[model samples]
Target: MSRFAPNRYRGKLIIVEGIDGSGKSTQLSLLSQWLRSQRLAVSFSEWNSSDMVKGTTRRGKKKQMFTPTTFSLIHATDFADRHERYILPMLKAGAVVCADRYAYTAFARDVARGVSRAWVRNLYSMAIKPNLAFYFRVPLDVALDRILGGRAALKYYEAGMDLDLSQNIVESFRIFQSRILEEYEAMSGEMGFHVIDATQSIETQQQQMRQIVMDRIGAALENDILRSPLEIDRAG
Candidate 1:
């Protein structure tokens, strides 16, 4: 068996993933706030952090240049950069890291966009897998409406496809969602995934997420509180 590294602090890496407008941002904020209240050494990061891909995706209303392949590649680069610079370091520091989106989005959306599953997975080979990933399940239409509610006209990649293509996309999302749902269900048994009732009100979801984070970081929060400036200095 591969034993845990004692000098390396293995903080729980938690990720929340789902289709656009699945309320991932809201849930991430709530969970981070709850962790702070409990005094846990937590760090927050996002995939599209004001980066090119996010800007490109947001520009969907102006012009659509991103195909499924382009979208997948952008996310792949985004995560690889994020993992190397932010995620891995914090995880090694024993600080809980919460990510708003992760590789699951690439897997789900790329498959929905007709990209081969193997190709998409290969692009993300550098990403450090999260210990726990929570997927918020919602219908495509619900997600679409929520996303489109913010604006009008398709941007670079957000072009609403033609009827036949649109149907295909929705169907793809359904197929992709179903596969991910099954994977998450199986992972639940192994403590890698925790499925939340996303259909519930946002408040309820926040509460549940807070409880989960608290459960994971209980000891860490206490340790931080006990470690005064002098104690930390001595340890350093």
Candidate 2:
């Protein structure tokens, strides 16, 4: 049996995952806007944003003190805190919960850092499977260009400098992100990720994503709309 089970909550959980600069964040933002425009209850979460562990993560990164195992465990703690505090409660309240990254991010990135895949998966075994998981697929070169074009320099950890992949920060990012990409590809089939070609124009990608989301949960959203106070007032 799969370690992660489908959630039984009334709300829908939608998540997007990809290596950094894959444009998954942009797509999720657009989707969240659309969901709100439809009057569906919507909530948002981002990985590593939990206050509980953010300070520790920052200090560790600043000091370059995190080994792969400690990094993995700290992130797991962050996810756990968010899962219990924000995700579960909002989901139970029937809010459409959108996440920028979920456990799969850890699965891919942690394993790419040389953590054991089985151990990492076991760490996130309590996570509820997302109703829709989108993997934004982009070529490494394209993703690199996009990231570097926007930023003056890569942060040390973001470049995967801790792994000693390359002396060049840009090259290190390329190699590190490549490993993460491979992990995502391997898990896509097993985890049923809807892969999006992220190299396309932003509008086109967003259109396809919106359509897929509508197809998956349009009826449920419509029901929520109908039950909303404004709709009830109109009917009365």
Candidate 3:
């Protein structure tokens, strides 16, 4: 399993998803580094990464008026631009692309904010599905504690909001978390959905994540690796 056989997938589109403070970014970096060490050509991407999306997030944060659905829409646009301009092309070229966040974030967060699950799904209906999606699972309290301890100020939906809204969001997130976990679990039953424990120490989590990536990209882990497939063609 050094590298995928040329016929395996057009390229590998790996998406790491989770709630805030889920340590996804750290693990994503570690996994990407490991892939590079194996001589695989890997590129990294993130949501709200483009200038337009970043500006939207900033303006919304400043105004503190954007709803969950508004935020979700912005993120969806970001992904559309990202996929059309970056991801799809890379996959076509047979390159491994790892995304820091994906539509699942929108699906979860928006639903927590009261957006219908159908609405969220419909918004991302055209987005590309990931070859492997890693959900970092952690306790709600632990994640909130980490956020509170961090230095960053709250953004839009998080800032200057009443306790009612905040509390509603929190409770909603709990439900959203459970539902998304179930969804991921179901998908995993059918395909590749790897759930990583987000409660572990940073070093331990990174090592575990790295090992998972190495295993999935096994054999392809050697020198002069070719591009991995993005979509698994079962028909062939």
Candidate 4:
């Protein structure tokens, strides 16, 4: 399948991408709240959260049954389910859809796990191109510290133990994430990602994100009014 062009849907799609602990999720949540505060219809979608495949993915992870190929396929299934059910419908309804992660996650992680980059991109060719895609770039060590500081132990796949990168989970995580980071850097230009320095204060990052988003989509959203039934009836 060829790459799908940006949709002509009434809504806008905004997505964030980064390694785990890069605080992309937090920034996305803030952006969503700001959009809603502005009276725009907003919806949120998260990566790998599709109920259709969540249980299966959990079991696969528990049993450590996924190779690089199987891992890629499973995530693709999750994305497809969300795209059709949650993302597409909300977009068609003129909602600002905020995604915590998108195809870029698979592109970086799957390739880091030894899956072919071309195949991974082809798997997600049907995805709608986002109006704004933010890539939160943080140093690997900083990301590691943030995640580990909040957790007791890293999960098997989360730390990239499957690839035998290191005996120690922490070391393996560093190595694996570094590979993913390299892929993200290479893709930043190719994918037209607006890269943000994530080590700044949270307030600073959020301020920058808000300014960028407003600059990009403010004109389109400014006049988008959601009328109540009474208002609609009066107009009619």
Local distance difference test values of all predictions, in order:
0.64, 0.91, 0.69, 0.90
Model 2, TM vs. native: 0.94
Tens-place lDDT digits, model 2, residues 70-143: 99999999999999999989888888999999999999999999999999999999998898999999989899
Model 1, runs deviating above 4 Å: 1-8, 50-63, 150-156, 159-192, 220-236
- Predicted candidate 3 versus true structure: per-residue lDDT over 1-236, tens digit per residue: 01212324466788888767678888889888877765677888887797668887787767766766677788888878887789877776667889998777776566656678677778777767776788888776787678658856553354324223334555644444555555544444343458788998988888877777667755544533454546578899
Model 4 has an lDDT value of 0.90
Best by lDDT: 2
Model 1 CA lDDT for position 235: 54
What lDDT, from 0 to 1, does candidate 2 have? Answer: 0.91
Pick out the ten consecutive residues of candidate 1 with the lowest summed lDDT: 1-10
Model 4 CA deviation exceeding 4 Å by range: 224-236
Query: For every candidate structure, what is the RMSD over all alpha carbons to the true structure, in angstroms?
Result: 6.3, 2.8, 8.8, 3.5
Which ten residues in a row are the worst by lDDT in model 2?
224-233
Q: What local lDDT score does residue 164 receive in model 4, on the 0 to 100 scale?
A: 93
lDDT of 4 by residue, 1-236 (tens): 22756778888889999999999988999988888777678889999999999999999999998999999999999999999999999888888889999999999999999999899999999999998999999999899899999978899998999999999989999999999999999899889888999999889999999999889887877755231233345655
Instruction: For candidate 1, write residues 25-142 as lDDT tens digits.
Output: 8898887777666566778888766364566666642465556677677778777777777877887776778898777666656665678867877787666666557778766567
The C-alpha TM-scores of every prediction are 0.70, 0.94, 0.75, 0.93
